[model samples]
Target: MKLAVIGLGMASKPHLAALKLLADQIEVVGLYSRSESRRAAMAAETGWPAFDSLQAVANSDAQVVIVITPPNARAELVQTLGAAGKAILMEKPVERDLARAKALVETCEGFGVPLGIVLQHRYRAGAEALADLMASGRAGKVLMARVSLPWWRDQGYYDTPGRGTLDMDGGGVLITQAIHVLDLMLSLAGPVAEVMALTGKTPLHQMETEDFAAAGLRFENGAVGSVVATTAAYPGGAETLELECTHVALKLEAGALTLHWRNGQTETVGEVTGTGGGGDPMDFPCDWHRDLITDFAARVQAGQAPRVSGRDALRVHRLIDAIERSARTRAIAQVEAEA
Candidate 1:
């Protein structure tokens, strides 16, 4: 299979690394960015062909296109590539908000293209193991879910133009940093019926969007949970999702999954790994990205939906919308699954 990657920004680093690992499985022929210098630098760095323009890449022989542009730069790219019948795997948040995000998905679907979002956290080994456990019924019914994403980012991190802004990154911690764990939480114990949240920016960082959030949720499955997502913590740590189920209690911190059974037996799957929660955002390994990219390539080859399809990713977007609404109205917002 032939693939291409667009937008030569910092986010492309992990994807490029993943592509390097999967080089034997597929050929990455074109890399594109608006800036000629960026294209030259990346081409020189990775030894991959750089496209003259996005249109050139779309018009090329690439079967899968990875879109790694910022949140504000997705709609037009998706439109162009979709019209060219390219399968797109994009980075998270879809767009700054839900409406544009939906349009991107619908555009690709309407054009009969496979669309996948890069919410790589769910691809962590421990997360996949837990998903399997729940599917096998050994995890039983979930009664409660508790999540915390205590992450730290220096002001310099936010100092990057549009780093923590509504127009560029789409809100702050909830949409950017914690969307990974929130999506995984919804995947495990969600379809949250309602959400009551408080979102605000702390004095620690000068940013337009919320850097901290505390929310209470009621899942449609009768499970209740609380969430604390913030970049205000001095030193960021791994995000955690602890589920208390009917038969077993599960704790998934970073990449490790642990189970506490009713009969006093405890078991663990996978091991704790760096989550890039600290001052340096790109501190973690590229293995998760590797697995996700490999999976997407195989699925695209098979004419099947990628694991994290655009429609499936909209689930978290909807929940984030509800959270923002609840924070504004000071009311418990109902999560409209279709909204």
Candidate 2:
């Protein structure tokens, strides 16, 4: 499979490395980035052809296009690729604006293009085992779900342009850093019916969006949930998701899972380390990205929907939107029905 990448930001590096792992099956044909210098640097470093414009990349023979641009800058480029009948794989938080995200999903659907989001947590071994256990009905119904992502980001991290802005990277913590845990929570507990949240910036960071967030959630399955996310936690801590079912309590810390059953039995499953809680934003390993990208390539070859399709990612976006709205309105926000 021939592929093209459309951003040379931090995400592009891991993605390129992961694509290399699948070199026997896939080849990166071209790259495009708005920053000429960055593109030149990437080209010099990787020996990959760098296109001058999005149209040039779109016009290439690449069958799949990977978009690692910021959430605010994704729609137009994605729409262009979709119109050209190319499969698109986009980074998380499909769009900063919920309405625009919905429009992007619709655009892909209108053109019959397959759109996938890089929610790599879903491809983790522990998460996969947990999801399997939940689906097998052996774990019983989930009673309570909770997620905590107490990560740290120094002020300098946000000092960069468009770091935590509402117009660029989208909402902080909840949308940017914690959305992976939030997506994992949704996967384990099912859809959230309503949410009440509060958001605020910490003294540590001077960005426009919140560095801290807490929320109360009510799921459609009668499961109660809670979320606490903050970049203010000193030195950061592990990102954890816990699900209490009638018979078993499943806890996932980073990418590892531990199950405590009602019968006094405990078991650990899967292997993968947590991303850096040491205040480095780019500290994650690219193994999960490799798995996700490989899966996308196989799914594309089979003409099937990817594991985390655009429609699938829209749910997480809606949840984030609801949390932000609830924070602003100081009232419980009902999650909009899926489009």
What overall lDDT goes with each candidate model? 0.91, 0.89
Clashing pairs in 2: none
The candidate maximizing TM-score is: 1
Query: What's the CA error at residue 59 for candidate 1, in Å?
Result: 0.7
Where does candidate 1 stray beyond 4 Å?
Answer: none
lDDT of 2 by residue, 189-253 (tens): 89999999998987788889999999999999888989999999989888999999999999998
Worst 10 residues of 1 by lDDT: 330-339
Residue 253, model 1: lDDT of 96
lDDT of 1 by residue, 206-266 (tens): 9999999999999998889999999999888989999999999999999999999988999
Residue 237 alpha-carbon offset, candidate 1, angstroms: 0.8
Name every residue pair that clashes in candidate 1: none
Q: What is the TM-score of each candidate against the true structure?
A: 0.98, 0.97
User: What lDDT would candidate 1 get against the real structure?
Assistant: 0.91
Provide the lowest-lDDT 10-residue window in model 2: 271-280
